[model samples]
Target: MMQLEQFYCRNYRIGPSESDFRSMYRPSAMLEHMQLAADGDLNAMGISTSEMLEQGLGWMLLATDLSILHPARLDEEVSLFTWSKGSKGVLWLRDFILTNHEGDRIAEARTSWALIDLQKRKPLRPSAMPVEVKAYPEHSLGDIPEKIILPEGRQTRETDRFTARYSSTDSNGHMNNARYADLCCDNLTPVELAAGIRRLQISYYREVHMFEQVIIERTDAADGIIWFRGMAADERGTVFEAKLQLNGAA
Candidate 1:
């Protein structure tokens, strides 16, 4: 059983405004919440890129699935509870629950990470991080949720592309995982689509490293569902997959 550390955060006024429903809550903001929570865990583990590698382990960005329950407004003093669920060998899991001051649930999210050898990029065993940081109480453990399925890939109907930059990649030397969600949302036709996001899932097939070109592909899987795939066109095929659910609202 893994014991999770609780994080209490005060919501700020810098979040997305109420101009429209789609932009009601930016994926970037949610990503920020996840980043903060992960940072806290890493600090608790006393594991940095250099420190972890000394123990025959390095960090690898994996995947994230976020579900929104309510909109967190700017400057709204909300509490975000985060904790590490479990880790099997090299793979690590973290869960988060965002709530208001009154104990109302706002959003829930889960992300996957891996610790690997810095030189060869191979996974390391569980004894890498310190025992206290790695050991988490399991009595209140929540079930790991499933990632959304990408129905299919489709030929892109639009010609817009986001320019790749070096800053997008994190310490793992790959494009920051959260930015992929932004790329998928950037491709949306704002005029035609009018809905709030309920769920988002992304699977990383390959890594998009520094100075690489990435192409965004979209798929319409039927009514009320859509899929987006991103690929690094240098030599490798696809790199990542993104799926989103948007509700049509007036």
Candidate 2:
């Protein structure tokens, strides 16, 4: 069991006049929390890698629901607690709780992941989980969420790619879980993102991490809905797909 310790960190940076309480604790901040959790998970599994290799496997692709409980304020100290929630076959389940210094719960997260053969970039059997770790226990995060699907015949509208930055990976040495959100959003127009979102969903077909290049493919948009898919070059064929809902411009 990986214990709750100082997993990872970043000091708060907002002045009283500069930011509001709610905006300060947006989903983006939660990304820091997820990065810490991914670190703990990697440690627990004993598959920890060096910074160089870790970046290639893109750490925990958070295939579950995340709920925010309380708002985190500027200058508040945030910490994370995580543990294995159990797994079904090759799907590994993990849970995380984010809290502030006063012990106030700020947010909760759960994730599902499939181990992949880093070289082949293909899904590996859950039975492949190291013998050192036990199978994920039983629990419900409501109905198991469905994976996001790429729209049929969607072609590349834009192709933006990134090499995992050293900062992108978590303590476990792989690309941090939250970076996926950053990457997904990178595919959108700034105007669309600023308008706000009602819901956002993404699915991980493969783990992406350091040094790998990823290509973003966008679906045709109409109304206020848009879809996208990202692919990385690898022997195994890993893909990341996402669907986004937008708020109309004022």
Candidate 3:
């Protein structure tokens, strides 16, 4: 059997469907692409999430840090590379680098994942995988997203509310991780949206099932970073939290 390459690359062109109202590629769509690339690479390496599910295991996103350096053009195909960066304790690491035709960087990301026993809802070590995934730590995309703690006493207001409808839920019977990027952007006020997304940092806390109403709460720091915390009307805990850095918010 031919051994698969540790690094994987895929090319994608932005189109009307991938771009938002701003005519720029949507972050949510970009994340979904990343997911597809990751899964494809994993399948080549001898394991796929679908295969894991049969064993009562699944992958869950813990945190992700995506930074956009330059937005890709709608007419141009961009090259994206992804590789596993090994694991840390129970958390598996993955990184991505996206570049345009000229080899100029478009975006990069560092993501953390955890394997879980689907039936028991318990985290498992990467060693439990039926096929071990190789790591290419040399391709790390920088630091993984850190846990975000919303400031105490900072004012946070409800920005938007919506039901986790059928269209948003995946086979897991809950919202997919990538969809939250659009949700976060949709809740942004015009001022915040106009600032433009330069970096997106997210920490997934829990799942939002179909029919559950999610109330998006937002706050901004003096430095221009907009923070969001999604809470479900029926759940006591936060569904997710995210930090958005605008083009010049640094």
Q: What is the lDDT of residue 44 in candidate 3?
A: 87
- Residue-level lDDT tens digits of model 3 in 1-250: 2122336988878888888677887898889888888888889889886887788988888898999998765667887788888998999999888888877778989899998888888899878988878787666657667987677787788878978888898866678899999988888778777677899999999878898888999886558787889997876789888888888875
Higher-ranked by TM-score: 1 or 2:
1
Return the top candidate by lDDT. 3
Q: Which candidate number has the best TM-score? A: 3
Give the per-residue Cα lDDT of candidate 1 at 107: 83
- Model 1 steric clash pairs: 2-136, 2-137, 3-136, 3-137, 12-74, 12-75, 13-74, 13-75
Ranking by lDDT: 3, 1, 2
Tens digits of per-residue lDDT for model 2 on 1-250? 4334533333334344322333554454465556555655566566654532454443345474566555566656666666565566666676666777766666666677766666655556755545355333443344445687865666657557677768776554556556666676666676665655544566766555678777777775567677777777564565677766665512
Error of 3 at 39 (Å): 0.4
- How many backbone collisions does model 3 have? 0
Query: Model 3, poorest ten-residue lDDT window?
Result: 1-10
Give the Å error, residue 239, model 2: 2.4
The C-alpha TM-scores of every prediction are 0.79, 0.60, 0.93
lDDT of 3 at 238: 91
Error in Å for residue 232 of model 1:
1.3
Q: Write the per-residue lDDT of candidate 1 for residues 1-250, one digit (tens) a residue.
A: 2222334243434344422354355776677667766666676566554565456555565677787777765556666677676775566877777777777887878777776676787766766555445434363325443544455345544334555677787765677777787787777677424455767778776677777887777875346556787766674887777777775521
Model 2 residue 64 lDDT? 48
Model 2 error, position 152 (Å): 2.8
